[model samples]
Each structure stands twice: as structure tokens, then as C-alpha cells.
Target: MKSTVEQLSPTRVRLSVEVPFDELEPDFDRAYKQLAQQINIPGFRRGKAPAKLIEARVGRDAVLSQVVNDALPGKYSEAVTEGGVKALGQPEIDVTKLEYGETFEFTAEVDVRPEIALPAYGDVAVTVDALTVTDEDVEEQLKGLRERFGTLKGVERAVENGDFVTIDLSATVNGEDVEDAKTTGLSHEVGNGQLIDGLDEALVGVKSGETKEFTTTLLAGADAGQEAVVSVTVGSVKERELPEVDDEFAQLASEFDTVDELKADLRERVEQSKKMNQASEIRDNVLEKLLELTEIPVPEKVVQAQADEQIHEVVHQLNHDDDLLAKALEAQGTTREEFESQARESAEKQVRVQLLLDAIADAEDVSVDQGELQEHILFQAQRYGMNPGEFIQQVQQANQLPSLFQEVRRGKGLANVVLEAEVTDSDGNAVDTKAIFEPEGDEADDAEADAAAESDADAESK
Candidate 1:
């Protein structure tokens, strides 16, 4: 096999590969044998057909088709490996020659990781938020967890914010009864912001069996931005009662023997989590600052692709947030198209950062181990409430396995590079980052375990 690459663009490559007949003969022969065993021919039992006779009977085209399918992937991959190309996605292969006795020739056009030269990556002054998980943070987290495990105690008074209300509701668009618009026994928490807007506000000060009508935009489909009159009848209202934050409560919630011990443990966990969030934020700021110092030509195609992703994500996040989306557009001094363009710009910045990191990874030989890859997949799967195996399969089916590895390598490489950087906080103070850099342990591991269980549950649900 022989291979060569032509530079089409900084991010794109055209690879010309040729596999000689000698190298591909074994595959062709194997394909022929496999076909012979399954194919029927007169005057011979299955698997007893002569090779040349079978070729004559079935035609070389049939054999070659099977051979081509089996041979192309390995050959293309081999060429890529031998050429040392770090490609981003799947290749588009064109077979130029593949006759029985002829050498195989093909070309694959693909996106390759762009190379970015390192700017002054050493000592930079950027403020890292100091780890300070307040009592409030711990209390808030505890409250959230308790609410999940909390019992509902019925109320006699009117509905109030923080009270759960079960209601029967219906909507009509311009007085055409939307036959599909009805739900009963719907449990809504006042001010929790799920369901329709103006709903919780309407529910406020309303008691059981009271009907109230309000106008709010439909939160789905083409009618999403259009207003409709909603009729809601409060069936019942209940107040949530949380378990006391005392030693006895701790004993019920966990293995902690005393309330003080539980409180201390909770505080420690919150502090650790806050520091992790802080470190992630620091990395973002550092990368932003570093990007400011680096310059590279931005491909229009790359920018457009990045822009589409951003626009999609932005639309998804804002799909339900009318006020926020409108305010964001106003703040950015742009329309939806303009905001999408800005999103594209943000995406380009990320691409630039990745390019810079890729070059560094190459120079420093950064690589992600199988274990690290598994860890990343597990973490991401858990984030999406998916199973690790399912997530891995999804990535593979999308032909993004290599991209996933590249992402992991990029992250690890950037982390390693920052370690070598002369970094200081925003106040120009040097950071003693050891504590912040340490991994958040066991519970995170347990979260990954939960992810495995969640994956099973997801599969069962599906």
C-alpha cells in the first residue's frame, strides 16, 4: 500500500491511496471463498465449486463488490495511519481503479485537525475564584435534595408560591376549542416555571375548585410565540414539608451519626464542588485570554458550520425563554440572524482554541488513554442521563469516535499546558492551585455508577 496527501485547506485534505494487486489479492480470494460456500451452482455441492468456474458463474462483479466493501475501510484507514493524518471526521472515498488484476486506487477527502501555533502560554495573570462555599450554598443544596425526598402536606388555604397544585386545564386558540389541549391531575409548583407562563401567577391566591383564566403563549410548535387563553381549575393545593436539618435527620438521610458531622460533610462537599466549578471557569477565562493573543485565518466554511451549531443550541435554550431570548438579542445589539452570527464567532473562537491546542498536543505528544476515554464518556453520559455504552455507541454510529478522542486529548493537553503556565489570579496574585486541581472523588465515581444504572433504566424504558 502507498499513500500521499494533498493540502486542500488548512482544515481539509485530499488523500490519494493505492493498494497494489498483490496486497489486495488475499481479500479478493477470501471474498471469493466466502461467496462460493453460500452460492449454488449446477453439478457441484455448496462450497465445492471451483474458483474460476464460480467466478464465471457468478461473475467477477459480484465477487469484486463484496471484496471492495471489506477492503476499502481497512485500506483507507491504513493509508491515513501511514500518512500520519489526524483527521476530524469520516472520509469520502472514490475508487478510481479496482479491476480483478489491477491495483486499487482511491482518493479520500476529509477534515483534518488544524494546526495552531502557541502564543506566549506561560505566566499570565488571571483571577481564579477562591474556594468559598458559604453556609447558604450548603443549605440550598440540602434543601433541594430534601425537596426531592420531601413529603407533601395538604393545605386548606389559597395556592401560594412554593405550594404544589394539582389542576385540570384546557386552552383554546381564538375560541376554536383545541381538542388536544387538555390535561388533568397535572401537578404544578407555583413559580417553578414549568408549564405555561402567567400560569403560576394566576394560580396565586386561588383556592381549591376555583377556576381562573389567563393568556399565555403556547410553549410548543408553530404556535409557540402566539398567545392563547388558558383555563385552569385548582383541584387541590399542598405545601411541601422538609425534614429537619438536625442530627436525627442526618441519621435518616445517611450514615452520619450526628447533625454536626453531617453539616461538616455537606459543607466539605459543597466547597469541593464550588472549587471545581471555579477551576472550570478559570480555564475558560485563561483560554479566552490566550485566544486574544493568538491570530489565525478563519475559514468561512468553518465559521458557518460553527455558527449553525451555536444557532441551534441558542434556539434550543431560548426556545422556551421568550423574555430572555429577546433581552439577549437586545443586549447583543443583534437580531436572530445577527445573534447566530455572533454564535458563529464564538464557535470560531473555540475552533481557534482547539487548533492551538492540537498543535501543542502534537508537539508535546498528548494522547488520551482508553481509561480516560471511558471516564469521559461515562461522565458525559451521566450528564445527559444516558448509559455509557449507549453514549459510546451513539458516538461511534455518528462516526465521531476519533473526534471524541481528539476532544479528550485536547482537554488533557490543555490542562497539562496550563500546569506549565505561569498563571495568577485576576488580582495579579500567584495561585496555589494544588487543592483546586485535585480530582473530586468517590461521589463522582458513584455518579458514574449511577450512570450505568441509568443506562439500564433508559434501555428498559425504550
Candidate 2:
């Protein structure tokens, strides 16, 4: 057996392989055995027919066809490994020659990873927004805390922003009721705008027991994308009375016993939050700069696959209904052509990023240790609200553990770039990335825990 490679382009290759008849004995033997079990012979029991007898009954060409079909995958893989081709997707295989006592020859064309020229990590530079926590920020945080401890009281006035209201809603399209669009006693915040369009404006001046009618385009359901008349009746209106910012209120709201202590803590939290935002900005800007500086050729097949996956996800979310998908696009004010164009653009960018990061990881000899992979798995599980064991099982079942490992390696490679690059705040001060972007250790763990706790606190405040 022998194989050779031809470089068709920077991101594609063709591998030509030839296997002599002597080298195909194992493939022929397996094919014969498989055929023997499926055929009947006058004097031989099932699975006991001789290879020559089976070949005589089925013809030599049939036997060779079965052998070629069974052996192409392994032979292609061998050719790929021997040629050192980093194929991106499945190969297009073509059998060039096949004779009983001669040689079997085939050619495989596939997309290969392109060679990338990486820039000096230390020479990269980026600037992020300056981290500045102000009195207004602290005051906003305090306001949120007070609102959380506030009590709702029955009010006699019209609906206002920040007031909670119980309402009954119904909609009709073309004078026909939409059963799915009707609900009773639904609680909503007047100014949130989380529900149907024009709802907030309609509720602004409506008093209890008053009915307001407005027109809105139904986003989903059978009447999706249809203009409907929606009627909302205010069942009750209640205003939230915030607790005063006093020592007693502080004691009731937090572990702190005094308002002064609470405010000080809030200020500290605002600063920490600003720093996290700064770190995120730096990471994004650094990657952008790296992408701008590097030239990477993306494989077309990989980009297509990514785009197809994106489309599949969207379709799956729409329950594989094209009508629902069209309605969703209409709701978002985008057309199918625009959506496909954006999806392709996103897929190209994603492929470029992955290729660049993978090259960097290889050049830097970045590796993912068990501990780092476990930490990543744990973080993902928590993010998706899955138990760690269950998430691991799912990942294993899907054969995505290798992809996960690559993700972690790419992350580490980017972190290394962040550590080596020259990063500065908008004010020209050197940003302290060590506290936020540093590699995992005890200090990093502590910082992560603190950030998680602060994030939970922020969510609770909301």
C-alpha cells in the first residue's frame, strides 16, 4: 500500500492511494465471511460456505465491490494519517482503479486546515474603557436594594410606571377571538414593555376596572404576524412603597446594621462590577485586534457546516415549522434573505476565530489538564442548570468531549495572549489584568467565587 498528497489549494488537498492485491486479503476475507452468512448453499450450512463457493455464486465483481465498500473508510483514514493531512470535513472519495489480481486505487479530496502566520503576542495592544465607579452608580444600586424590600399597597389612582397591575387580556384578529392570546389576572409592571407592543403606552393612564384597546401584531401562535385588536382590563393597581434608607431599613435588608455601612458596601460592589466589565472589554478588544492583525483562510465546508448548524438550531426552536420561522423573522423585523446573510457572516467569523485560536494553541503548545477541563465542565453545567454528572454523561454520549477540550485549549491560548499583550484603560493607565484574567489558581478561584457571589447579589437586587 502507498499514498501521496496533492495540494489543490491552501485549504484543500487530494490524497491518491493504491493498495496491491496482496494487501487486501484481510478486507476480502471479512467481505467473504459477511457474504457467506447471508447466502444459502446446497451442501453447506449457513455461515459455513467457503469463500470460493460464495464468490462463485455471487460473482467476483460482487465480492470485490463489497470489499471495496467495506475498506474505503479505513483506507482513507490511513492515507490521511500517512499524509499528515488535517482534514476539516468528510472526504469525497472516487475509485480510480479496481482489478481482481492487480491494484485498487482511489482518490480522496478534502478540506484541510490552512497554514497561519501568527503575530508576536507581546506586540499586540488594546485599550478598554476606564473603570470608574461613581456616586450615581452606588445610588442606583441602593435604589434597587430598597425596591427589593419595598411593599406593594393598594392604590386608587391610574396606572403609573413602577406600579404593579393585575390585568385581563384578550385579542381578536379579523373580529375572531384568538384563544391562545387570552389570559386573566396576569401580573405586569407597567413600564417593563416585556409583553406585547403598545401595551405599556395603553396602560399608562388606565385606572382600575378601565378597559384599554390597542392594535398589535401577534408574534407567535396561529395568528402570528397578523394585526390584532387587544383589549386589556385593569383588574387592580398597586404601587410599591419603598422602605426608607435608614438604619432600621438597612438591618431589615442586609446583614449590615447601619445605612452607612450598606452604602459603603454597595459602593465597593459597584467598583468590582465596573472592573469586571473592564476585563470583559479588554478580552473582546484584544481578540478583535488579534483578528485584525492575522490573516486566516477559513475552509468553505466548515463554514457551511456551521451555518447549517445555526439554521438547524433556529428551526428546532421553531419546532421545524417554516411558517413559524417566517413569523419569527417578521416579528424581529428581518427577512429570510437578511437572516441567511447574517447567519453566513456569523459562521465565517466563527470559523476564522476557531482556526486562528487552534493555530495559536498549537504554536504555544497549550494543553488542557484534567483539572482545567473539569472546571470548565462544572462551569458549563452550572450555566445550563444541569448537574455535573448528568452534563458529563450527555457530553460523552454526544461525543463532544474532544470539542470541549479544544474549547478549553483555545480559551487558555487567548488568556496567554491577554497576559502578554499590552493592555491599557482609556485614561492611559496600565490595566491590572492579573486579578481578572490570570490563569487558574487559589487566588483565581477566590476571585471567581467573589464574582459569582456578587453576580447572584446583583440578580437578587433585580
Candidate 3:
């Protein structure tokens, strides 16, 4: 088979394939034999029909059609390979010419993965959050530790900060008891300012069995937004008794002897966490900067598909919000169209970023460590609350391990670039390496935080 190709676009190509008569001969013979075996001719035994007789009955066209069907796939693949097609999806094929004892030719077009030209991806400087963990951070973690083992003692007085209150809440929207409305024995920490506004204020000065009414936006349930009147009667209130920050408390809370020792250990941990986070942030910034400097072309189909995925995610979240329709219209400027457009933009960015990153990965010979892959798989299984063995089996069964490994390696590659960069704070102060090496709370999703990052990058690139 001989071939020629045309570059329609960075992400698209047109391949012209020509399979010579010599290559078509074997398929012709196979087609004749298969047809002769399947058809019934009186006084003829199976496999006993001659090629010439089969051809006479079926005609040249029929035999050639079968031969064409069998031969096209291999010839098409060969043409694509020889033509250097970096395909994204299945090809669109059109048979231009097909005749016995003549060259068979066809035209194929497809969406291809575009080549990328990165600009200063390595050693790119960026400003990121400082890893100067204060004494307040340590105190906060200590308080959290104390609360974990703290006993809830019934309080005879009004609800206060650090007190857990049990209450029944009812809400109405424009004086209507909406659908999916219900009550629960909800435990709330007074002054948390998380659940709903005015909740802490309503709980204040209230004893057991005392009812209070306050206005707040609904966090959940049917009346999610639009000023709703909430009626709550406190059943009980308990004050949390935290352990003292001492030698004994330190041993119980952590593997340390004294409170000072514990603080020292925690400081080291905090520093490590800060470093990891800074490293991740700087890498992300590098990508952002690279996107700003590079030129990466995005294919339309890829953008559309990505937009659909984003819209689907938004719509799913919308179902859980009561005033979601209004909120979306107000925020996005349209009910669905605007959101879809934004999604398309996001998709384009993602496709371009993936292209560039893949190019970088190729250039640097980036690869995943086997031990790390196993460890990451096990870690994910635990996170999703699944057994490691079962998770590994499922991941393999689904054929998603290769992609997952690629993500891990991509992160590592980004990390390598970040380490070499001259990162600083907003004030242009040089960032400290010891401080930056601390773990940034559980490695947040770069994991998920910047799903739209590439989209912005795509725009900047364009």
C-alpha cells in the first residue's frame, strides 16, 4: 500500500491511500472461497466450488465488494501510520476508487492530536502563598485534637461558642412549605458561621425546649435561598471540655512527651506541608505562565466535548440548589447557552494544555515509578473507602491505570519545573525553601482546584 497525506489543520489531516493490485489479490481469493462455501449450488459439495464458477454466479462486483471490506481496515491503518496521523477520534473514510486489477484508493480525514511548542516551561518564576505557618495554625490544630477526644457535657445555660446544640429547624419560602422539606436532629456548633446565617444568633440565650425564630438563607432542603423564616427549638446544649495543653495531654494527642515537644513536632509537619503546597502552586503558576507565552491550537470538536462535560457538571450541581436557576442566570448571563460557551472555552484550554504537557512529557522522558503507582492506587482506594486489591483489580479491568499513571507523572514533571523556579511572595520577597517544603493540607486537587485553569490558558495562548 502507498500513501500521501495533507495537513488540514494542526489537529486534523487528510490521508490518500492506494493499495496496489498485488496486495488486493489475496483478499480476492479469500472472498471467493468464503462465498463459495456459504452458497448452495445443486450437485456441488462444500468447498468443492471452483473460483471461476463462484465468480460467474456472484459477479465481479460482489466478489470485489467483499474483498474491499476485508482489505480497507488494514490498508487504512497502514496509510495512517505511514502518513503519521496523530489521531484523536476515529477517521472518516471515503472510497475514491475501487476496481479489480487496478490500484484501490481511498481518502480519510480525522481529528488529530496537535503538536505543541512550549515557551519557557522550565524555571518559570511565580508568586505563591507563603508557608509561614503561625502560632495560630498550631493552636487551631491543637484545638482540633482536643475536640476529637473532648466530652460533651450538658449545659444548663444559653448556647455559646464551642457548645453543641441540638435543635429542630423549619423553613418556608414566601410562606410556602416547599417540596422535600423535612426535619432532623441536627447538631450544630454555636458561632461556627457555617450552616446558615443567624443560626448562632438564634441559638444564643436559648435553653432546652426554648424556641427561636430567625431569618437565614437555607443551606439545604427545599427553601435553599430567598429569605426564609427558620423556626428552631433547642432540645439540648452541651459545652465541650477540651484537654489541657500539657505533658499528659501531649502524649494522649500525639506521640510526644511534652507540650513543647508536640509543638516542635507539629511545626516540622506544618513546614513540610507548606513546602509541598508551595511546590504545587509554583508548578501551577509555571503552567499558567507557559500558557500565557505559548501558542497552542485547539480543535473545535475537542472544545465542544469539553464544554458538554462542564455543562453536565454544572447542571448536576444545579439540581441540588433550590434557587439554582435564578443564580445561574444572574451569574452566567444565560440559563444554559452562556454556561455552554464558557464550558467550550474551558474545553479548548484543556485540550491545548494536554497537548503541551504531553509534548513536554515526551521531551523529558517522564515516566511513573512502579512503587509509586501501586502506592497511589492503594491510597485512592482507601480514600474512596475501597480495598486496595479490589481497587487495583477494578482499575485494571476498566483500563484506566495508564491514564492515572500519566497524571501522576505529569504532576511530578510540573513539580520538577517548580523547584527550579524563582518563586516569591506578592511583595517580591524570595520564598524560603525550608518553609515551602511543608505539606499543604492534604494535597488538594490540582487534583480539582484548577479544572478550568487550562481553559483560561487556552484563551491566553490563542
Candidate 4:
């Protein structure tokens, strides 16, 4: 077998391959064996007929066709490997020549990984938002904790903001009842704005058994974007009574014995949360900077394929109802054209990011060990709310293990870039990015546990 490559473009290639007849003996043998099992030769048992006999029965053209079909994939893969072509997606193969004893020739056109000139990692810098946790932030956290422990008491008065209410809601568009928009005895919180547009305002000040009517545009269903007259009948109103912020209340709510101690812990937790948010901002800003500095040309075919897949998924979620898609887009103030345009743009960006990170991973010789891969799989399973074993089996069945492996490698690549780049807060203070992106091995875990135990001992001693 001999192969050569033609550069179709930076992101694509055409491979010309020629395999001599002598090199295809294995393929011919397999093809003949397969045909022998299916063909009935007078003196031979099933799968025991001679190749020449089978060919005589089925014709040489039939045998050659089977051989060509069976040989193409392996031959194409060999050509790609020999040519060192990093093929991206499926290849389009065209058989150019197939002689009786001379040679079999074909050409494959495929999308290849483009050559990317990586930017200097040391020169990359990004400024993220400063980590700031104020008293109000701690108070907000405390308020959430209090809300979780609050008691709901039935109120005899009108519904007010922050009150929970049980109500029956029915909507009609132009006097025709909207079946999808009607529900009975739904519990909602006033001022939460989780349900319909004007539901919160309509619920406020409505006493039990009082019905309020409001006009709002339906966001989904058949009448989406059309104004609907909604009738809401309040069944009951209840207010949450929070316990006082005292020592006793602290003991009741947490292991802490005093409100001051609870506030201190809340403040520390809020600070940690703010730091995490800062780390997230740094990751985004760093990626944005890298994209700005680099010029990565994405393949149009790959982008189109991804965009089509995304559009298909969106339609699938909508139950393939074109009208529902249109109406939903209308309610969101977007048209089908705009939605497609946005999807294409998103797909292009995603492809660019994947290609760029993959190149980085290759350049840095980034590798994902079994442990890291397993950890990533577990994380993904938790995210998708699937059992680990089930998710693994499903991904394996779909042949998506390589894609997941690539994802892990790309993450490690990006983390390497982040570690090399300079990151600072908005206040011009250098951020401790290593702490955020660095792997916490067993040593780090042991250190953390020891520190925690020491802190607990100190608290007890005090």
C-alpha cells in the first residue's frame, strides 16, 4: 500500500491511495469466506467452498465488489495514519481505479485538524472581578438559612409580598380556554416571579376566595405571545415566621451555640463562595483573552454539522412541532431566522474552542490518566443525575468514550494555560489562581483534614 496527501485547505485534506493486488490478499480471503458461507456450491459444505468456486458461481465482479467494500475502511485508515493526517470527521471516499491484477486506487477528502500557531502563554493576562464579601452578603446567607428553618403559618388576611399562596389559575386567549395554561391548587410565592408575567402583582392583596383577572402574553403552548386573560382564585395565604437571631435560635438552627458564632461561620462561607465566583470569572476572562489573541480557523462543514445537530435537538425537545417552535421563539422576541443564526454562531464558537484546546493539549503533551477520566465521568454522571454505572454503560454503548476523554484532556490543557497566564483582580492585586485550578492530591487532602482537626481542637480548648 502507498499513500500521499494533498492539502485541500488548512483544515482539510485529500488523500490518494493505491493498494497493489498482492496487498489485498487478506481482504480477498475474508470476502471469499463470507461469500462462501452465503453461497451454495454443489460439492462443498457451508463456509467450506473454495474461493475460486465461489467466484465462479457468483462472478468475479461480485467478488471484487465485496473485496473493495471490505477493504476501503482499513485502507483509508492506513493512508491517513501513514500520511499523519489528523482527520476530524468522516471521510468521503471515491474509488478511482480497480484493475484485475495491477492496483486499487481511491481518494479520500476529509476535514483535518488545522495547524494552529499558539500564542505565548507568558504574555497572556486577564483581570477578573475582585473578591469582595460584605456584611450584607453574610446577612443574605443568614437570611436564606433562616428562611429554610422558618415556620409557615396560615394567615387570615390578604396575600402579601413574600407570602406563599395556594391558587387555581386558568387562562383564555380571546375567550378560548388555553388547556396548557390551566392548573388547579398550585402553590406559588408572591414576588418570586416564577410563574406567569403578572401573577405576582395579581396575587398581592388578594384575600382568600377572591378571584383576580389579569391580561398577559402566554409564553408557551399554542397561544404563545398572544394576550391571554388569566383568572387566579386564591385558596389560602400563608406567611413564614422566622425565629429570632439569638443564641437559642442559633442552637436550634445549627450546631453553633451563639448567633455571633453562626454569623462568623456564615461570613467565612460567603467569603469562600465569593472566591469561587472570582475563580469562575478568571476562567472566563482568561478564555476570552486567549480567543482574542489566537486566530483559529474552523471548518465550515464541522460547524454546520454541529449547528444542525443543535437545531435538531431543540426541535426534538419541542416534540418536533414547528408551530410550537415558532410560537416559543415569538414569545422570546426572536424569529426562526434569528434562532438559526444564533445557533450557527454558537456552534462556530464551540468548534473553535474545542479545536484550540485540543491543539494546546497536544502541544503540552497533556494526558488524562484513568483516575482523572473516572473522576470526570463521575462528575458528569452527577451533573446529569444518572447513576455512575448506568452513565458509563450508556456512554460506552454510544461510542462516546473518546469524546469524553478528549473533554478531560482539553480541560487539563486549559488549566495549564490558566496556570501559565497571569491573572489579577480588578483592584490590580495578583490572584492565587493555582489554588483554584491546581489538583488537590492526597497530600493536600491530608493537610486540609489536619488543619480542620486542629481548628476543632482549638475551638474545644477555648
Winner by lDDT: 2
Minimum summed lDDT over a 10-residue window in model 4 is located at 452-461
Question: Between 2 and 4, whose lDDT is larger?
Answer: 2
Measured over all alpha carbons after superposition, the RMSD of each candidate to the real structure, in angstroms, is: 7.4, 4.1, 5.8, 6.6
Stretches > 4 Å off in candidate 4: 439-462
TM-score (all chains, Cα) for each model:
0.69, 0.93, 0.78, 0.92
Candidate 2 TM-score over all chains jointly: 0.93
Report lDDT per candidate.
Answer: 0.73, 0.85, 0.72, 0.83
Which has the better TM-score: candidate 1, or candidate 4? 4
lDDT of 2 by residue, 1-462 (tens): 899999998899999999988888999989988988999999999999999899999999999998889889999999999999999988999999998988999999999999999999888999989888888999999999988988999999999988999999999999999999999999999898899999999999999999999999998887788889999999999999998899999999889999999999999999988877876576667777888999998889888988888889988988999888898789778988898888888888887877877898898898767776777778778877999999999999999889777777776677778778899888999986775766467647433433332332222122
The alpha-carbon lDDT assigned to residue 68 of candidate 3 equals: 90
The local lDDT score (0 to 100) that residue 23 gets in candidate 2 is 81
In candidate 1, what are the lDDT values of residues 383-411, reduced to their tens digit?
78998889888988999777667666666
In order of lDDT, best first, we have 2, 4, 1, 3
As for lDDT, the candidate ahead, 2 or 3, is 2
Q: Residue 19 lDDT in model 4? A: 93
Off by over 4 Å in 1: 31-70, 95-104, 123-125, 128-158, 221-225, 238-270, 290-358, 367-408, 422-429, 438-462
Clash number for every model? 5, 0, 13, 0
